[model samples]
Target: MRLNQYIAHHTKYSRREADKLIESGRVNIEKTKATLQSVLQEGASVFIDGKRIVPKEQFTCIVYHKQKGELVSKSDERGRRVIYDSLESRFKHFVYVGRLDFASEGLLILTDSTPVAKALMESHLERTYLIKIDGEVTKEMINAMEEGLVSEDARVGGHSKSEIVAMEFAAFAYYEILKNDKKYSKLKVSITEGKNRELRRFFGVFGREVLDLRRIAYGFVNLNALPCGKKRYFTKEEYKSLHTFLKEHSTKESKKIESRH
Candidate 1:
């Protein structure tokens, strides 16, 4: 783990705070000042403000059912309500996994463990969503979903301010067309990658506007029975499954590092 990540996972300090501490020379590894690029090795002595940071044996994870009109952010410049406003004060410091966009809603994963959050978000775990769109579901759209798409001008449905103009969409893991008509369509779709505005952009290629989007699941986590705006801790079985996934993920990452060396 990097120094900032180490501080974030082992202590209450966030990654940004850890960076600041390191920059200010308050963080030391083996009595030597640590830099942002410093990588932590097992049994290495790490200290901040003259005290050792002992890694916590356990971490907390939770799922929040985000509702439409809520931004997945800590704050908004335009004064719109953010997820933090709906979350309890105790969870104020927890980091959200992936975003749910302002108009989208449903299950959102959050955790106090930075490593866990980073791992899950970067993983190619399946994300399933329920989406409603304008116009009928066409054969071309189905072909794109099945064969994947590469758009050089994918800015159509993306945020106007987004700099991304090109995007590569992976083939959807699964999709079911629940409804179809000249005026509207609805579907359940699953994809592995979580590119920015991916689903919207894909539909934009077919000139269909996404009317509603709600993420129902990510990997093994689901939003079952979780009311909008409500939050809950992971069940024991969920925790067990998560730990298993994390262990496997960590092993794979370590192997990649070893291979690179």
Candidate 2:
């Protein structure tokens, strides 16, 4: 891994922050100034600001039931409450696996290992959600959910300030209509991709507003009976499953690298 990645995986600083530290002449490898492109050597000592870094052999992972109004960030400049405010200080340095928008709530995974977080985020794991929409479930929506949709302008249901315009929505992995009525409609949906405001944008295309959205599960992790704004450690089975997943992911990544070479 690069110097910044090595620092981020072993320390509380993010990759960007690690880059800044290296540029400022703070990071060192065996007393030699570390550069941005420096690759970590196995069994080599690393230091930042004169303090030696000892990488942990084991990493911890946790799941949090994020509330509807909380932002998945360290700090918001606008004074809005963030997930860290509700989460314990001990987890302040953990990296989140994926994001849930301010209006959306549900199971969120955080881990001390940046590698684990990045691997899970990049994988095509299914995320299941229970969503309620403001209008009836139309045939157009059903067809789109079944066959996928491409939008030239996909800014409708996204953040008002988001610059992303064009988006292609993959066909939902699975969907089941739970309730359909004139007042509102509810559905259970599963998708493999975690695109930006994807569910909202998909519904927005059909002129339907998502009134409520909550993720119930991600891969092997599930919210179960966890209350809002609370957190819990991974179960024994969950840990086992995570270990298997990480192993397979590492193998696949290595294969990709070898193919490239």
Candidate 3:
């Protein structure tokens, strides 16, 4: 395997991220510096940033149920509570699959194989969330979200010249009315894409403010009632289910989209 591939396969960084390490001269092949196109010498030593790393096991993949207010990061300059802080010390080397914002809570995948993480982040995967927001969630609001919304808001990654809704449409996969208090209501939504802060912005178009957001599932993996601020390795059955979801996602998305509400 190429040096970049070797690093990505062995560590948490992706192939693209591995290339950056090589470019910065932090990677070596048998004490000799390695470049992007360099391949392994059958069996040789490899060091990253002067730390020799022998190929370990298959790789570690963990699912964490994050709590609100815990940042999904290693360390924040703001010194706020972070997800890894509450996790086992061993997870210091792993990177999270995606992120749940500071105010968001629920499922997150952490792993040492970027390839696996990248596959899960692909557009075909589904992410489910339960959101509590101000005011009643009316049919019109749901329909607008399902049909998609329009805005020239570049802040949401929309092209200023294009219909904002055309950039990406987040559909509600499933939802339930948990509350209808005149001041607040709760509902769940599932979307395919992981655009930056997309959900909060999408709902903002209809004058809804998401007060609390908790992700419950991602494709085949679910929080499964796991306690908050805890992490664990996936089970054999869970791994198989996630792998199956990745394999079938392309075909599944089409059907899922057509049948979505």
For candidate 3, write residues 1-261 as lDDT tens digits. 456656766776777888899998888887788887676887788899888876864666789999988888889998999987888788887878888887789999988765667767774568888888888878777686667656554243222343445335556555567787769998777777777667777666667778888899887778887998777789898888866765575356446644863
Q: Backbone collision count in every prediction?
A: 0, 0, 0
Question: What is the per-residue lDDT of model 1 for residues 180-227, given as tens digits with 9 covering 90 to 100?
Answer: 999999999999989998999999988989999999999999999899
RMSD of each: 3.3, 3.6, 7.7
C-alpha lDDT values of all predictions: 0.91, 0.91, 0.75
lDDT agreement of model 1 with the native: 0.91
How well does candidate 3 score on lDDT at residue 256?
A: 64
Greater-TM-score candidate between 1 and 2: 1
Give the runs in model 2 whose Cα sits over 4 Å from its true position: 1-55
Structural similarity to truth (TM-score) of each candidate:
0.86, 0.83, 0.70
Estimate the TM-score for candidate 1: 0.86
User: Model 1: C-alpha RMSD to truth?
Assistant: 3.3
Worst 10 residues of 1 by lDDT: 1-10
Which residue pairs does candidate 1 place in steric collision? Answer: none
**Please, what are the lDDT tens digits per residue for candidate 2 over residues 1-261?**
456766776777877899899999999999788987676788788999999988866989999999988999989999998999988889999989999999999999999887789989999899999999987998998999999999988888999999999899999999999999989999999999999999999999888899999999999999999999999999999999999998888678667755975
